[model samples]
Target: MEHANTAQLGRGPVTSSDLRRRQNGRLASIGEPLPIGMRGADAGGREGRSEAPLPLILRRVHPLILLSTVLMCLATGARAQQSSTATYSVTFQGNWTTASTPGGVVGGAHFTTLIGAVHNDQVTFWESGGTATAGVERVAELGSTGTFKSEINANSNAISVIEQSVSGGGTGSATFNVTVTSDHPRVTLLSMIGPSPDWFVGVSGRSLLNTQGNWQSPIQVDLFPYDAGTEDGTEFSLSNPATSPQGVITSIRGTGKFSNVRMARLTFTLQSAIPPPTPPPPPPGGGGFGGGGGAPRTSAPSAPRNLTAVGGDGEVVLTWEPPLRDGGADITDYEYRVDR
Candidate 1:
């Protein structure tokens, strides 16, 4: 019953076969309008009885009414659109032995947070051990996140933490932010690299386009380095200078010298989704190849919730239910479509 179309004929209260199947849901009701058998010629086309407008007879033959009036003018310009998003923030600065020894990256003396394990866009708190499962073993043993922000707020999701530990480090390090309202559309970030237990830092599951209202996207990245099987890097802790680094390592499997721990380049960006222009679809079978959406769409995707295409019939597939930000798991990927 919700399938209202035919370009919503005359605007409302439909019944001319519901505006001819909202314009053409695949017409199949032959025989009705060609009953002008005796209107004894009037006004120009010459008719007289004047029963108003009751002359029809076009059930099909014209390309199924031009493909059901182009899938109801592409499902009425997709219900007059209304799904735009934007929200952002990113920062992870800490670990300094002389101010991080000019960016060699090293930490551990105590500066805990774990930030309740990310909040928005589905709590994702780092994974690369078993790869991940709620930042297991405090992100691979003692790298510390205090139970991974307590499992992203016990799975209800939404976490925030700020600690300066008596303000000697001057309230710095750990500032991951992302706040774009108006229906929300994408975000995700995480971190872990203390005393190098699991060695983690990640970002995934993103899509924040609005530009002017603000969501933005412009990413350039390079990341790879992990080895947190969970405590076995054999250390003594307190041999001479409170030692904990003899051979310095517990488990690195077949150890290729900590299997190539190198790669960290950066650049990031992603933004676009503006909603407002709806109600404009009465030109399908008559004329229209493209007009709105501002830009993006060569036809094929079908969007708004209807996936499983595997790149066949014009391609279009989507999937969800596995993304956790703030606490961080680093979602990986999921954008479905944003085409025009």
Candidate 2:
């Protein structure tokens, strides 16, 4: 349904009379050849058919409508043949030091909570060398995820956005799982490098689709530094007011106080119910179509065992063994939640 223009079509069913009028109007505008068996002396001329008129509904279907229907059918078949889920384990590696030298931008010591999304190509959270949107400006200037979340949530192409805190100064990581269709196969991530003024690191418009038009698995990408251009502060710690004229969102050139630093890493793993294999071809003599495989697998792994929690001076520790049955594939990751 990508690029399908259904905005003009109303939700209610179209009456026979209305459909015919719409079809006639569209055919006149397109001026394309009629479909097979749809052509006749009366097709393009003003003259009417002498014999019984052909089915009105057949002529009413607009070319774009027909194309949309074909695309829908193809999409259905694609869903049956491909995986529809993808999970990404992202790590924030903060290498910037806090100590500012005789003359250098204060090192970006910590990173605020990471916020990101898996969306279609049509939606982009932020762009380089372009004016930063208000949402991006807020995140870069204030280290707040709410604005970014709100902005992307309003976009129709965004499939999912997730937020999790990752302490800076060292490597902190979080995992995000999203259901993805073929039409939406791109991912984006952003996090403010805290104690810095309008500086953040992330990936923009990174695609999950491989060359073969399928979701790529275990895809890895490195993060780059960008200036949001909302604040004029040169050092990590903001002391100055907004610049006279806000700069356009731009890459942090390695030559200046803001260095092009590689700050994080991300890995995306796409998962799906594996389809059954095709049967081998028969000998020269013809044989039956051949029996296909069995039903789809939909079982989940058992939960962890021997879960133990211990409280220390100011921290709680947790440990547990892997699940007894890992369903079918290997247990690649684990998820934990703490309720207030």
**Which candidate should be chosen as best, given lDDT against the real structure?**
2
| TM-score of decoy 2 | 0.54
| Residue-by-residue lDDT tens digits, candidate 2, 222-304 | 66668888888766675557755878877774634544545566666665523235534433432221111122223455665
Which segments of candidate 1 are over 4 A away from where they belong?
1-82, 90-171, 174-186, 199-231, 234-281, 284-340
The C-alpha TM-scores of every prediction are 0.26, 0.54
The lowest-lDDT stretch of 10 consecutive residues in candidate 1 is 331-340
Task: Please provide, for model 1 over 165-191, each residue's C-alpha lDDT reduced to its tens digit, 9 standing for 90 to 100.
Answer: 211131234433444444344334334
Off by over 4 Å in 2: 1-83, 97-108, 168-170, 258-261, 271-340
Residue-level error in angstroms, candidate 1, position 326 = 34
Residue 162, model 2, lDDT:
68
RMSD of each: 17.9, 20.2
lDDT of 2 at 205: 76
